[model samples]
Target: MHTDARVLNNQSLIEGDICIIGAGAAGISIALDWMNTSKKVILLEGGGFEYDDKVQDLYKGKTTGQKYFPLKASRLHYFGGTTGHWAGMCSPFDEVDFRKREWVPGSGWPISKKDLDPYYAKANETLKLGPYNYEFDYWRKELKDLNPFPLDDKVIRNKMWQYSQAHFGDLYKEAIVEAKNIHLYTYANVVDILAGEGVQHISSVIVKNHEGKTHTVKAKHFILACGAIQNARMLLASNSQAPRGLGNDHDLVGRYFMEHLEIASSELWLFRPFPTNLYSWEYGVTRASAELAITEEIQEKERILNGTASLLPLSVGKHQKPRMETWQDEDPRKSSESLFKNWSEADEAAKSEKGAIERAFQLNTRIEQAPNPNSRVTLMAEKDELGVPRVNLHWELTALDKRSVRRIHQLIGQQFGIAGLGRVKLMDFLRDEDDDTFPDSTNGGWHHMGTTRMSDDPGKGVVNADCRVHGISNLFVAGSACYTTSAAPNPTLTLVALSLRLSDHIKRII
Candidate 1:
């Protein structure tokens, strides 16, 4: 059954077996996993079905260090969450992302990729994606006439990406509302997480709405599946009972924030027309496509982070603007409109060379930033109308992050030249070997990750391998926020898979 918390009586006492906070991809995925189960699942969404500027304002905050999207417009607060407008790119994290790399500080996950293989298959169904296979060979067999570049496998490889069209709100709204076990509360925003004795277990949560109504939700277990920034804000803001906030005794609740740096890195000028559909993709029509990437062997040799380079027509790419600049509107709707308009215009400009890929291609680099503890989300002094602390994002990049991007392209360029594909012209910002600073136009992937990172050691991370809070017994986190290291592909697929794994663990206990 679905209920609007705003309509519930003030100080209402809602009860459930499990309370899953935030109705985004992660939260909704976990809730869906419990549809026919015996346990009563309480799913809380801060906003209703549609976007409201009032609720959006609750996400408003400041950004420092690196340039970023407006916090208010960066994510959607409605029932669907940010998936309402997410680009459907989906790929699993590389195995190296789980291993500890000595060169990258704060790297490695407590859980290995092998632990998530089964969960990833289940998540593929939830996301409405094709086979769980991410290998280019698998896709090449399934599709027709898709020949790959003859690059040495030891150095560079083609990374495959599958698209997911499943928007949670639209795809699962009916099932969620009709489910007898699910108690979805829209307009219910969690403001505080109360703890039991010793601050070792979650007692209940305090939720408030814009209508001045406050309610208490009591559950045996509490899972925070909100976005990374919001998840960190809630943990940092609920510090009344626990002076340093629950699960943050080690002063590591909101640190090591990371994002995929998506920037125009270089131009791959191929020799003559290399007629192949390997690197091109039409968003809605294509099921899967491949991008240039470095192998783990090469990454280990060069000590660089994993990243992928997608091809764009030179005409459209050179004319395109950085997403940071185009997505500046404080309202997500306006910001989305501006962004799509720019993409549509670029598509129109690139139509001139549709039949002929004959010459130059722009390589847009999407790489993970080294986990910098200094880059983090902290509690803002100003509170929202709901009396919850807003988020302050300090997005900082490391020297390793910069060098990794340059090195990735340089490796790809070398491989291309060796194969006599063509020479690669590095962009101005990448040419300077001594300069560590990025241009003002450098764009971020809008993928928020790693605030409440996972680890086995309490001193190093907030959550354990099972995603439970280090010290808190019944409190857990399910989302990209638990990521110990961000990988090359987008976080949506891996986060959903991780949520499923957490759901299975919760099932065993309950």
Candidate 2:
């Protein structure tokens, strides 16, 4: 059953077996798994069915350390959460992403990719995606024309990505509303978490809405399924009991903030026309596209971080500019429309100049940043309408991140030179070795991760392998906030897989 928290009386108490805060992809996915089960689940969403200006204002905060999108505009606060505007690109984390790399500080996950393989397959169904096969060879067999770049496997190999069009809210709303065991409460913004004696167990959560109604949700187990930034924000803001916030005894609640550095870094001038069908975007159907990724052998030899480079024809890439206006808007639907319009214009222009186009193409980089302790999200003194402190983001990038991008392009250019296939012109910022500062064109994927990072050691991470918050048995964290490393692909697929894994653990425990 679905209800609005605003309509409930003040100081009312709602009880459930399991309470999930934030009805995003993670929260909704978990709740769906519990449908028709014996468990009584309560899912809390901060906003209504659609976007609201007042609720969005709660996300407004300050940003420093790096030029970032306005805090208010980074994520949506509706029933579907950020998935409302997601493009649905899905790929699993590489095996190397889970291993411990000597060059990457604070790297490695307590659980390996193998641990989540079964769950990833299950997640594909929930995401409304095609087969879970990400192998280039598998896609080549399915699509006859899907040929990979003729590069040495030891030096560079092709990586695949699948697409999905499922918007959780629109696609699963009916099922969720009709589920007898699951209760979804909209406009139920979580303001605080009340802890029991000894600060070991969570007694209940304080929720409020703009209508001036307040209530307490009491559950045996509490899971924070909010996004990375907000997950840490709520933990930091709930300072009534633990002082440093619940499960934040080690001061590791919001540190090690990571983002995939998505930037157009160079231009590749090829000798011949590359097959557009293999690399260009495809809709509705699941297809594989090749991105030049360095092999693990080379990463070990050079001691560089993981990264991938994608090619785009110069004709289409030159017209592409940073959509700041779209990103700064509170409503994500506007951003999605703007993105589609921009892509359509570029596609039309590319087709008109098909024959007259040059051999040149743009090289885009999607590189992972090494986990740094200094990069974090802290609470600001200013409070929002709910009297909760707003967040101040300190997004810091390291020299290694820049070095990795430059090195990947350099290696790609060298291979092209040897094959007599193309020549690459490095971007101005990358040309100078001394200038480590990234250009204004450099932007993040807006994929927040690694805030409440997982580690077996309590001193190192906020949560353990099972996503249970250290020192707090009844409280757990969900979503990318528990990611130990941000891999090259988008985090949605892996995050949903992780959520499914967490759900199983909760079921086993409860």
Candidate 3:
């Protein structure tokens, strides 16, 4: 039987077979998986049914590393979590993202891509995505027939398109409302954990509300889907009983923080012009044979399979401009408008400006960042109103990260020229000869990842092979944070797959 906590008043504590934190993509996916199970499931979300600034302020922190858009009231918090602002780009991780590359340090996942393939179909069904096949033939019909994107010229190459465009809240709302065994509680913020002897087991979780009233929930298993940053923060903040924090025995809970370093505001002018009408048809759909296809054939065939990367084609106005800002004016009422209006107010000048070359495609090359311990999210001395310590986001990159970016630039440029897409110019315009001159020139993609990575070794990573905290018997993690490698593809789809996989694992445990 499921109960709506929002309808219930204060001091409401519920017990279940499993308790999931954060009702975003990860949590909802897992909840749906066990909806008909015999076990009682309780899903606790920090925010209420709607978005609010008072709760959103809980995610604010001191920014570091590259410049980033301030944590938006829209970006960080709420009932649905960050999925509210997500541009539903869905692609699976490259096979290389699972392998342990000798060249990249702290690499390799406890489970391979094949290990998770079975769940991808269910993931697609949950996300309202297209068919299951990832082969190029699936997307052949969607091509404009002029010629395949230059990468297609390479005989071993495989390309895929956008498979799923969905909002988690809307997609899963009806099912959740009618779920038989899942209890969803909004406005209940989990603040602490009560652990058993030796801190190896979790007894129950402590949650609070705006009224300062609290409730404690006991469950056989606990999974934190509160996103990459908050997952680490919660574990570190629960340091009262466990001195180094829960599952931090190796001092490795929040280390090795990383985010994709994206180069943007760049343009790719067409060598041969194509029809403008194709934009609507080709924008985003991913089935192996639909409008898009991406496969690992090229990297494997060329023996260049150390790390992962993806090529994305964005439609832009005929004329292209160089400048890209941290934020855009998507919502006028949002803080981004006030902070970024100066640059956006000048959009009229930007559009009418002369000497601009018409662009055919806006290509963004997102590559993997190898884990580096120096790049981390440490706990701050100060605590929140609930006494949970804040997270000090210390995201950093390594020399290998720069190499991957440079190699991607060279490969994309060569492929564009070969495929007659015109010579691709980088947004970060460093000459090929001056590659090693400056490393920090690239900008943050804001696609944050790592920090509490999943690995086979308990000593080196926070979560074990199945995203279970090593010593902690029933605690698990889901989301981009568990990613062993921050691959080039958009992580939304892969994260959902992992979440679904976690649910399957939980079913077996029960």
Candidate 4:
């Protein structure tokens, strides 16, 4: 039931019970749930099964405010989406990430962690993960000689991470093609969403492909499972009915963007060799990494955002160079190969000097940036091959983001001093309390989130608790775009879980 949209007749109307756009992790997960069901599901992908430079160039645009990766290189526009090159790091959002914090602006989700608990377990199966466990003690019992740093729980605790090798395009392609009730259309890019009377319901979606073919997809329900940036861009671009864009009356469609502040902030010089395999990266099996995180109690006292710092061997970290500078190729595969080569060389160099290395490591910070409305994705004047406006990203970081990183390391340094673990040398940028500017080395996890944030109040968010667009009945938005707050962990797990939850809601209604 899978076909290339270019092969279909131009201006043909393809009707279905449900239409899910962007066959990425979220879109594929949702489509799988409806397999063999009576509902006729149509899934759309912008690109073919593999990478195409022409399609990737559609993602290129201007980046203002904070320096960022080239928009074209930041994301992959293939069937699997960005998961094609994902590092497989996965973790659920903490409970505190859902609750409102006075310090973080536009923080809090309408639903709590408990609400997504069942779906997270279901998402684990979809992700081909080991188990639904993230506890440090659980991993400690499973892993031999696995021990944590001697630190107070009130001050610092271990944050667990799990890895998944499932590439959605490769793993689920056969199943998707074989599904009787599901029809997947590759190279079908949704250029506009045609709205019905009063812009309350979707009539159909205008789709185009590079082959110069255009068609229409009509469905009872529509779910935008495209990644954060494209989801916002599409909503902002479909301005035929609502004028300001469909369901964009509040001017909140592409606002409140958030990303995890990933930076190598400091060095941890331990007094003795820390022989533990728990934190090291492992594949094909479940493992947990220890990250020094400040407790929720301390966060309330200090009024700072949530953050975690993981340790890496100094020998390995010192050799690790920035890839953005040299990775100028437009094709993601070439860039990925270059990055892998660099990491391989660095790993070899680190191993060669391993015997002479002292008890020292590097501290890397992964922190949540407070939601700022100014940080957004707006439509650029330049149009892509499909004649749709490209996205212009204005990624903004707050002073609180800088302060939190400095404070977290300072607190960790103090605890290390008290426990006699060793001494911590703060990075030059963090040493200056008055310096609010981030260094060029300061980068994000490349995790895009929070543009179409969910909220109970229509005035605040593009979608509601059910992920349905505000004032729109049959339209829903899936993926990290609906995330209210981007947690320190990667957004894949939580976003897939939320997609499953949305699927359940759709089933209940239909």
Candidate 5:
């Protein structure tokens, strides 16, 4: 039956077959999966329908890594969550993403890529993507000869994969409001999870609002769908009763946070068939000549060969050379003076018809990072609105992550040369502290993961093979936080798939 959560204070506490915290992408996906079911489901959210100062205040913090004004940052803590501003880039994790690599210590997932293939297809459908194929050329032809910008100085090509255009609040509004057995509450912040006798049985969760009022929810099954950071925050904050936090028996609640390190830059080049707005409206990359700089095949081979990374195709802009900049080291292979001279000559070249053919695609690469236990999040002395401790994020990158960056650059340089994409140039003097885009410099990450990792053994993980919290028979996780490995792709698709899988398991239980 439909119920307004605000009635909890005057009336009785709400009880449900399943209770989910946070109404973001994963939470909404789970709610939608059981929309018309007989089992009662309640979805709790911390913020209202739109972005607000109070909601944004929760995300305020001192920057230790990537420094940017909080106002300009795209992340949000509202009803719809961060998906409101998400660029909708959607691509499934490759087979290698689920495997354990020797170079990537503490990597490898309990499940393999094959296990999620079917769910990946379902994720594509939910994201409105046409299909789940990476064959760029065949799809290019299928698009009626829509081509990528042609360039001669660089080997420029386009890569196509699924992209997402989802806004969970808007996408699932009808289902949520109309569902016979579902109740969605706004401005309901989950402050704590109250576990039963053994910390293995999660009996209820405490939620609060701006008015200093509190509400409690009891459920047979509970799922934490809050984003990676907040998910850990809630668990750690609920420590009044549990000494080490609800699922901190192994101290693996918030470790191995990761984000796809993106490098964007721009420069002029001598290439033909230039179009400034290449693939701006396409679902994926559009240029025809571009080859897969990195692929599942490459990643698998790398894993087998003990290599640590895979390459994806890089795209250059068509005209006005997209004005972008990042740091890099001066090529050691060529003296600085020699390269400077060549750059000066190229810079002096006129903008002619042939130069119009010269295209520049803004290229970005997602190099794999090896997991290090040192990079972690722990509880801080500071407390939030509910007199609970805050989370202290301690993120670090291993030397292997740096090595993978260098290796991927080398691989891209070689492939661009071999495929005649262009005169490939590595980033220059980036490690120099003086440079804005130096190696030691930090960047912001939207992909938060590995906080509550999944594993076959409960000793090494918080979630079991099926995503249920190891000791807690009724608690589960369905987001990037459960990932064991950070693949070189967006985490949304995989998250959606896992949420669906979790729904199946929850359905069977409730």
Candidate 6:
């Protein structure tokens, strides 16, 4: 049953077996997994089914160090979370992504890809993805003309990707509202987590809204399914008892913030027109596509981060501006319009270019940023309408991150020369060998990760292997906040799968 928290009386006490905060992809996926179960699950969403400007203001704050998108526009505040405006690209992390690399300072996860394999298949159902298999051969048999380039398979490999436009708000709204066991609460923004005696366990939480309504939620188990930014902000803001922040005895709650570095790398000028649908996407129509990715062995040998290179037609792509420059409007709606308008103009201008070469394509990179402690989220003194402190972001990138991107493209150029099929011209920013700075055009994938990272030792992380907050027995975080390191692909798929794994663990313990 669906209930708006605004309608609930002040001081209303909501009791449930499991209280899941922030009804985004992770929260909804976990709630759906509990369908028909005897447990009473409470799913809380700060905004209603649609976008609300007031609720969005809570996400607004300041950004420092690296240039970034407007805090308010970076993520959606509605029921669907950022997926409401997401491009819906999906791919699994390589096995090496979960392993410790000597070159990457703070890389490696407590769990491995093997642990998430079953959950990944189960997550595909929730994400509306194709078969669990991401093998190029499997997709080649299923899709038409999915042929790879003539690169050495031993060094470089195709990173297959699937697409899904499943906005949870639009797709699962009715199901969540109709479910008998799940209680869906809208306009319920959790402000502070109230802990009992020793702060070892979360007793209940305090939620408030702009309507001057304050409520309490009591549950046997609490799962914070909010995004990485909000999840850390919430923890840091709830400093009444745990002065250092709950589960933050080591001062590591909001550290190691990571994003996938997405930027224009080089130009791939093929000797001849490469005719294959393998490395292309048709927006909403294409079921699956592939991007050129460096093999695990190559990454280990080269001592670089895992990344993929995607091809965009040089005709239109050459004129395309960086995403950081185009998506500047504070209002997400306006920002999207501006971005689409820019893309449309680029495509339109491409049609009029007489000398546009069909054989050339821009090689854009989607790579993982090296985890740096300085890249973090902190709490600001300014309070939102609900009296919760706003967030302050410091997105610091390291020299390793810069070196990795340049090396990845250099490797690509070397491989292209070996294949004798094309030549790669490095971008202007990468032309200078000693330049250690990224221009304002540097674009990130808008993936927030590692704020509440997981580790078996509390000194190193906020959460444990099972997603439970280290010091708090009944408190858990169920999203990218627990990610130890960011991978090349988008986080939505792995986050959903991780949430499912957490859901199963909660069933056994809670």
Worst 10 residues of 6 by lDDT: 350-359
lDDT of 3 by residue, 320-388 (tens): 222124253223136444534544444444556444333444554455666888777787777677677
lDDT by residue (1-510, candidate 5, tens digit) is 334454456324778889988888888888888877788898888777776666556654432443322311324676667787675776667666778776567778989878887877777777767776656566665556445534332322344455567787788777787888888877777888988886778888887766666888898999999888777777767776678887778888887766665443222232443343324444344322232334445444544211212221232222222111121212211222343454344445433334343454434445444565666667777666655565566656655555445444555556645656554444553333234332433333357777888888877887877888887788888788888877766678889888888888877767
The candidate with the higher TM-score, 3 or 5, is: 3
Can you write out model 6's per-residue Cα lDDT over 1-510, one digit (the tens) per residue?
999999998999999999999988999999999999999999989999999999999899999999999999999998978889898899998899989899888777899999999999999989999989999999989988876888898888999999998998899999999999999999999999989999989999998888999999999999998899999998998889999889889999899999998999899988887785888897789999999899999898988889999998888897788999999999999989998999999999988975539888899999988888899999888988888888889999877777778888888888889999889999998888788788889998879999999888888889999999997899999999999888899999999999999999999986
All candidates' lDDT scores?
0.91, 0.87, 0.67, 0.88, 0.63, 0.91
List TM-score per model, in order: 0.98, 0.97, 0.85, 0.98, 0.81, 0.99
Give the runs in model 2 whose Cα sits over 4 Å from its true position: 323-326, 330-358
TM-score attained by model 6: 0.99
RMSD after Cα superposition, model 5? 8.1
- Residue-level error in angstroms, candidate 3, position 416: 4.0
TM-score of 2: 0.97
C-alpha positional error of residue 83 in candidate 2 after TM-score superposition, expressed in Å:
0.6
Clashes in each model (backbone N, CA, C under 3 Å)? 0, 0, 18, 0, 28, 0
Between the candidate structures 4 and 6, which one is better when assessed by lDDT?
6
Residue-wise C-alpha lDDT for candidate 1, range 231-348, written one tens digit per residue:
9888988898898887889988889998999999999898867755878888789899888899998899999999989998887897688899999999989988998899889878
Q: What is the lDDT of residue 473 in candidate 6?
A: 91
Mark the regions of model 6 whose C-alpha exceeds 4 Å error after superposition: 354-356
Query: What TM-score does candidate 3 reach?
Result: 0.85
C-alpha-based local distance difference test score of model 3: 0.67
Across 363-450, the per-residue lDDT of candidate 4 in tens digits comes to 8999998899999999988899899998999999888999999999988898888888888899899988998888766777778999
